[model samples]
Target chain A: MKKLINKPDDVIREQLEGMQAAHADLLKVNYEPFYITRAGGPVKGKVALVSGGGSGHEPMHGGFVGHGMLHAACPGEVFTSPTPDQMHEAAKAADGGAGVLNIVKNYTGDVMNFEMAAELAMADGIKVQNIVIDDDIAVKDSLYTAGRRGVGSTVLIEKICGAASEKGYDLEKLSALCRTLNQNGRSMGMALTSCITPGNGEPSFEIGDDEMEIGIGIHGEPGIKRDKIKSVDEITEMMTVSIIEDKPYTRKLKEWDFGKNEWVERELTDEPLKKGDKVIAFVNSMGGTPVSELYGVYRKMAQITDKFGLKIVRNLIGPYITSLEMQGCSITLMKVDDEMIKLWDAPVYTPGLKWGK
Target chain B: MLKKDHVLSWINRCYEVLEENRQYLTKLDTAIGDADHGNNMHRGFKKVHIQFETLQDKDIGAILKSVAMTLISSVGGASGPLYGTFFLQMGTKAGSKEELSPKEVAQIWRAGLEGVKMRGKAEPGDKTMVDVLTPVVESLERDVEAGKSLVEAIDQAVEAAEKGVQDTIPLIARKGRASYLGERSKGHQDPGATSSKLILQALRDSLS
Candidate 1:
């Protein structure tokens, strides 16, 4: 609540304005249904990747929009899903005639809005498809609840799928690859502190100085349980082990069925992380946690991987995806084959992530 | 009979009620879900209020449809799509008529529930907005069929909605972010359901 800001109402617009001014070289901003697209956009003949969600998780959908990452990102109010109009406009802006792929998270609101946008985009004669990322292992229900909330793996999917699209994969191919990446990825996160969304101007959930949320979702959704705050190694061990040993997540998800040109139910089961898996180990700070703390997390993560006989071939440590000023970290372990590693290495440029241009 | 003026009054009262209870709604949500229900509802209604001039001249169906569009675009959370679909379905049944008989009013509520069911995939015990809305519609229809006046039917709807709101306090959530809390979500009132009751109360007041 003490953070610098003029007013809660102006939070998102002002942030976007600052982002637009600073990153004008790589991105272009639009309002009245806020969205951002790559400045040199409509990368002709390649599939366009559009992703969006609530705004508190920054350097995510928006910051990733650039040369070789997301083509466009639709931003809603803090912790609120964007309306369909923004998604539809983003699709139109990013469309290069090859078709568009919407990378949507698995939260109920986000899924519904993205699905509506896909239908609208298709009606306008732009071929549209979508992949829902529900890689978080925190939420235990697949048969009942709204399904597991999408979290850390979202960043991985954007990078890999963005590379595939930039490499001239068509909409169909890119979407297929996205599903593959999502299937191979599983994540678990913990929160040492709660994030305060600007609009609410209050911590999402109150926790004591001695407690922590063990399996928190990105939006500050309640996790498995709260307990006395443990050492970093202990926290890291619990999250990493849960992701590695999680059962095959069974759930029904909707996808844009190309053959029928309509949304259809697709059952997806995430394959568990296995021993001897070659993986890209990602230790991401949840905005408020410092990079130095992330290194501490990675140090413990590497130890855990070694004990499990899983090889950490490559690693990403930073705040690539974050909950606004929330002091926590989420670990994503993606079982990577040559194709995925190749795509992960192919990223070019973006405000939040950049390398291998 | 539910007239066009009644519909306009309902919308106006809805805006006022949400604005009045915005902070309370947010505080309720802070305990179990993201604390934005009040903020979202107020923002959605504020848009409808701004465009009320243009919407007033349209038939009830068109007016409700415009409200749906404004809400779907303005409200940012799960409520945006849920409430937007509620009004959209009501608009379809109410059509272009300036007024409605009791049977027509029941039809509008029926279609609205169907839309909520389809959009949220919620059931009676899910501790969602459906808990309040589904019962309100059922009570409204039953009272109308039992030879009640328009005011009597709305009174029944409001009573059922209030009861439904009370019912949500003990149930475990099976949908949305609240479900993430498991048994801990039991004590907190469902913010969405509480707001739904407010909406029904507004409808009843407008009819009187």
Candidate 2:
């Protein structure tokens, strides 16, 4: 608690004020303590997008606000969900005349709060839709237990869907993209150390100098198991295998029969795509993972992707998403088409995320 | 005779135990798991201590509910939600009661045990808080059925809890971070079980 702070009560407010001062050109501070929207609002006729969650995972919902990403971001206290009031303000602020879309992670409190905000917005005749991100494969009995925890891949989905919204794809297309990403993308993480909650002034979990946590969530939620610390390569392989096993790239798309009509399967006519299958690769660093280690992980991921005959059409590497200082990273790969490749290269600028122009 | 003040004193005593053992708990976690049990418990109990000030006008259930919420929000680690859920469940069962009789205390303990099971999804052999708590609740209920006084029943319950905590040292962990160790978890005492023992011990000491 010896850190610099005027008061614990004003921590979120002070941080928001500092963010406004630092990036006034890129963002506008809303009256609500944790809400920030783009200065000019959503580009006219574009789908307004809003997202937010607990505060400790910085640069997530907030930093990703800008022209190409989110129109508004709402933040909660520490790991707590932002109240409905904050979300309502954010939804109102980001309405670009088309409508508003909420990108919410699948945490119980976050879902409940965002749902409340959507309800409130609807009361005022605002058309709002929501897509929940739940990409973590680590949590088992997910359909049974509070559903899969939304982990690192959320950042990737935000960027991809944001790009789609910017392209005037309408609510249906944005929702479809969101669902496709959630269906295709999977993430698993491991932690070398526990995060220290700022107010608590100590690590959230105790990791022996030698031990590491495998399959950890962002909240330092206990992972699938704790085992002896493994080398970087082993840990990376473990995570990758889990993800791949869950969502293997079935290059072949099967045909389905409707009640009245049947569609034929699309055959991969090419020579097994030596290195030309477009793929967007994301190497997401959990909060405590450093840039150096994240790069190291990418190096390994590149090798693995090469082995599978998939070319890395685009790569995003950094702490795009985090779990409050938890030491780990998750890798996300989306097999892309020519259209997606073009969209991925489209220009975009946001405080927390940025891509090709 | 156990008075209402004694129950309140037990809460304070449990806070003291968490404060005193914070570092030790963290150190133990450091060896085999993420090292935050001690710090998490410390942060949670510290919040609980502050909550007690505002709970003077509330009944036992309200007091426990406050403790549970504070722990859930303030403590981020597994222990926070686990312990918080335990107390929250206990409070839910305790309802608006001013004070708990021995049988009621035993039932409250059972509720807490069930809550932990629901939250952590741990069983008796999981080498978790349940290993210690389940035994104490059973012993307390048995003691009460045997016509023991409230204080005596609690004392016997504390003894059973201590033994249950000790049993965790030689057993392999089947749940939580310690389970990641598999056979390696056998030598170290389960931090959760240890804390549960301390909770019972605090209650006993407060009664004296």
Candidate 3:
């Protein structure tokens, strides 16, 4: 492929090195082969958070490495998984007095590699707990295949979980919270333009200029439907309505007591959700979508959230996670309790992600 | 035909095939699935190639195991685990053996299919590699029952696999990421089935 790279084999290495050089204040380059975290890693007494996957989706595990996110991110070759050895080393490096928590996506390779790495680390006296992210709602049958692929909501999960860990939640508690996040969150993405792999040189797939696919997975996998491009409002309604109906978030709100200071059992209803309840809103770009478009989506999301009266305690807007250079975005909303809201506001700093601390 | 070198050559050939098709596979995946299938298989096969080089004097089982480990590590999508588990199960059946009888080969194929079933949790109508593999394995059994030698059975298996791959074009995917497309998946040949056919073809080519 004709791109600005020294060699096809060295693209990930070169890109990571460049990322390190450009963001020196926020990043650190690990030695060759096992490029895990070394900058803004977990403190001596804090629990470590490590996550990674293929290299094409930038600002994910790597960029999110800083104060409030991952302790280290093991970047594999473009769209490939990092070997178990790399994950093992990252776990060791990030492990402070508290154990290390590995945030793995639900892809088979990622799951197996991370599982093997956890086994290897345990054999080496390292305590590694793993939480797999499977928040995408594009797929319905988790019983059949490997389940839904982790998508944009993974960034929000990491941020919230990191906040929990920062608040001195033990490994078990953090792991539990991670599972809760997975259960409570849902995402759906779409694509307009296909992305070009660094070495492949050409677009991964041919998309007509006028058409769009909805219910697409993050990796540019075919979507549920290929049809005429719809307006932003139509797309938003399709995604949000499906997810909301699937999860029945509006009905779940009735089960919670807003001011009585306790969760109360109630019937599921379609009533407008009340304010004062905590929520996290994420407008994530799918690789190539610009910030301007994402903001438009965020504005739409804000309008929708307003109708529900869901308090937007936290709003994350950016390409925190991506699908190479595919053109689209997914919106994720996580209803939070008071404790989660506090953690969401905690400060932390890392390469591409930074807040509170 | 069907010598020990034949299987080794087939594995090595698969590495080559994956290397060559990496971009195309990833490109196809970018359209309807995660954009990493090409890179994942390429990485897995590259690792297998390295392990093959390192374990030159080892048995076929060792070689297959090495390949399996490599694929499991390097490939990051569904194909990685399914293909890796396929080799791993094959290796488990023929552990450290320098060669296999026709029966042994058939058994290995069955075991490999079982492993794939266990890992992917897919069935024939799901429009998965199973759609290709199930028929091939059955064809292998049928050929062996008809008094065919190992080479003959493998030949029939490859033919069945090719047919199965072609058949995926009309069927809707009901498993894996592609299954999410429902009826839209029709018309395009299943990529996993295509690669699966290629792999079986490699084996047949090496056998003959």
Candidate 4:
């Protein structure tokens, strides 16, 4: 309940205003139907990459809007999906002559809103494609729960796809790369404490001081299991092993079919992590978790990967994707090829992520 | 006849009910869903209230459609689209009529229910708003069969909807975010169903 904010309702707007004021040289904020875009905007002829979700997860979609990253980002209310109008206008503003690609997280509301937005953009003669990330191993695919919740892998997709777009990759190329990244990555998260949503002014769920939630998603949803807190190594290995030993996950997802000019269902399966595979080991703090604890996770992650004979060729460690002040971390291992490796290292400049510029 | 004035009264009644019960409905949502149903509903109806000044002289359908567009734009969660789609279907079915017959009310109710079902893909026992709405429609049908007046039929429908809301207290959710909670969703009254009851009660009050 204790946080710095003027009012519950004004949190998102005030934060956007502050972010725009601080990073005005790199980003522009628009209100009424709120959205953020690159300062230089609609980079002509390059595919426009747009991604968005609820607002609590800061420095994501919004902070990543700059050169060599997301062209525009839609920020919704805290933990609520943005409306289609925001997405439609952001896409229209970000779209160059090439096309537009929407990187949507796999939550139900996000999927529905983005689908409607893509349809809207297409009505105005814009070529748009949507790729839904379902990389979280936490939510077992069932007829009950809506597939896997998109988690840490979303950050990896945005960075890699952003570089690809900057390199002149067309809509098809970028969309294919998105699918490739999604199919090759798996993420698992755990929480030490629950986060309080700003609007509700209450914790989404409760956990005792000694308890921890395993396989948690980014939105403060209760995880798969609650158990007594263990050593950092033990908890790290548990999630790491869950990802490594995870089996092939198969699920049906909807993608826009340009030929048919309608949304068509496609059953996509993720390949399980295997020995001798090369990967990018990403360790992310779930908002409240500090960098020191995340490094502890990555240390254990390195040892575990070595034991499994998988090589950690590249790595990213920080709070890129996060829940609202939740105490935990998620690890994503994306099996990458040489092409993806190059793109990951490509020059990029944004408020949240910047390198090789 | 469902006049524009009555429709405005219904909307005002809805806004008042939602404002009063916002915290209670949100507590219900916290047990299963994302805990924002009451806030979203309150915010949506408040936005609808703002447009009343411009919509007061418009036809009943036009007023309802304005509410639909406002809800769709301002509310930001599952309830937003579901309720928005409901009002849009109802408004469109009611057409531009300044006043509607008893039969037109029945047709409009059915269309709104259809829109909710189509958008959410939820059934009667799925523990959703549809649970309350289904019984409301059935009650209207019964009152019509017994040759009751439109006001009487609508009153009966509101009571039926209240019963339906209570019925959700023991059912498991099969759709929306609450569905993810599985059996944990049982015992908590469905937020959407409770909101449905409130909406129907507002309509019945407008009849007086």
Best by lDDT: 1
Per-residue lDDT over A1-357 for candidate 3, one digit per residue giving the tens place of the 0 to 100 score: 446778777888778878888877766778545565746554787888889888878888888877777778899876666777688888887888788888888775677677667877777877677777777777666544456778876888888887777778888788778877776677788888777777566676667899887877666766567878888887877776666556332211111122663334342222222455466888888878999988877876777677766677788888877877789998887777877778777886777777665
Candidate 2 falls in which docking quality class? incorrect
lDDT tens readout by residue for model 1, B6-46: 99999999999999999999999998888899999999999
Fnat measured on candidate 3: 0.40
Per-residue C-alpha lDDT of model 1 across residues A118-141, encoded as one tens digit per residue? 988999999999899988888888
TM-score of each: 0.98, 0.66, 0.85, 0.96
* Best model per DockQ: 1
Worst 10 residues of 4 chain A by lDDT: A138-147
Score chain B of each candidate by TM-score: 0.98, 0.95, 0.92, 0.97
Per-residue lDDT of candidate 2, residues A231-259 (tens digit): 77777777765665563222222222224
Residue A332 accuracy (lDDT) in model 1: 94
Winner on TM-score (2 vs 4): 4
- Which residue pairs in model 4 clash with each other? none
How close is chain A of candidate 2 to the true chain A, as a TM-score? Answer: 0.87
**What's the CA RMSD for each of the models?**
1.1, 8.4, 6.1, 1.7
- Residue-level lDDT tens digits of model 4 in B141-194: 778778788998998898899899999989987777777667777888999999
User: Roughly what TM-score does model 4 have, to 2 decimal places?
Assistant: 0.96
